[model samples]
Target: MDSLEQLNQRLREGVRCDGDYPPVPGEGNPNSPVVLIGHSPSGTDAQTGRPYSGPAGELLDELLAEAGVKREELYITNLVKCWTWREENGLRVNRTPSAKEIKEWVPAWLKPELELIRPKAIVCMGGPTAQHFLGKDFKITLQGGQWLELPEDSPYLKLTGHRLDPKPFVMGVVQPNYLTHLQEHAPETYPAARANLVADLLKIKRVLEGKLPKPKAPKQEELDIPF
Candidate 1:
């Protein structure tokens, strides 16, 4: 994991894939101080072999532009590198990885990525993702956009089995899909939520500018693993 080349080679050579879809290795600055981790790939991501695509990608691009951030300046990837789905009513639908699936994949896929990039901060794209590193009851409405640290036993760290010294700080933000949904189905609430999303996006810039203080790991109490 000394380089992105080694990481991607491991992903391509040693990693097992169901062969329905291959792992979507992260794209962007290999040494970025921030990484955006999603729960898993969407249908479009699987099809295009990219992390964000279609509506979600569009919204993310626009938000990055508005926040005065460039995509190439940040690393982006999903916790689960490949896509997961189930068939229902004669249709194929996207689904989150099961606890079992996550257990099987994360150490192999995500651990090394973090080890290589060593981002100083991460943005969890949605509640479930936020919960992965933060705890289950980490209320996004109350805590999003604030400086925080992952618990010592945070799933991302433990599952990856790699402890980054002075571990990367954490922040939570609304997923693009949620914002898109809000815009389409709940217009009344969309404006306020979208504004919050923009503010959260800007925090990345503040972090890079050395304006926000790095968070120390909060005291450990029993916290729910968001399986």
Candidate 2:
């Protein structure tokens, strides 16, 4: 797919992940410097064809604004195309997707998206996303704001339909949805999570600006040790 039209065509006619949702909005540039990857669009977002249109998105917009990043500056998307939700006790609750669903659909659409957008940094929003991209061994509490280098042969590249070349770095941050939970119950931790989001955003900014090189790998000594 050489253009957005082709990409959308492939997503619609070529691949069938979830048809309940609308086509992903925004012209996801393969050349964008940063990419913010999250879970599927929330109920509101799915309806509007915009990522993060709900409460969590509101928090994300606030946090990004604080970090001096505009919504248009970075490419944003989700690992899953449809919301995995069911009515529970008369209210709808989002649930983590089954492994089978991810395995089947991720490579078909989401992974190719990363290869196409080739962001300088990919901020995995929550544990599910981090687990998908970083691996099952990833512990969000310990490594949430820390940087991990992409594998030597990982597909962080700009694809000219077939050719792929290194394009950007990938990073992880606490998901805004997680913070929305904290904001409702654990108000104290909410600020810290938001701060971490801003700090991570700034770190990525510095790396992109050439002020800081790729972050060094975290050592055991730097692990989060909550006593």
**Top-scoring candidate (lDDT):** 1
Tens digit of per-residue lDDT, candidate 2, span 34-53 = 67787566767767767777
**Which one is best on TM-score?**
1
Residue clash pairs of candidate 2: 120-168, 120-169, 121-169, 122-170, 125-175
Error at 181, model 2, angstroms: 1.3
Off by over 4 Å in 1: 13-19, 212-227
TM-scores of all candidate predictions against the true structure:
0.88, 0.79
Task: State the lDDT of candidate 1 residue by residue for 63-149, as single tens digits.
Answer: 988898888889998888777888899876778777787777778777778877878888988767887888766766667677687
In model 2, where do residues sit more than 4 Å from their true spots?
Answer: 9-19, 23-30, 152-164, 207-212, 218-227
The RMSD of every model to the true structure, in order and in angstroms, is 3.4, 4.5
> The CA-based lDDT of model 1 is what?
0.77
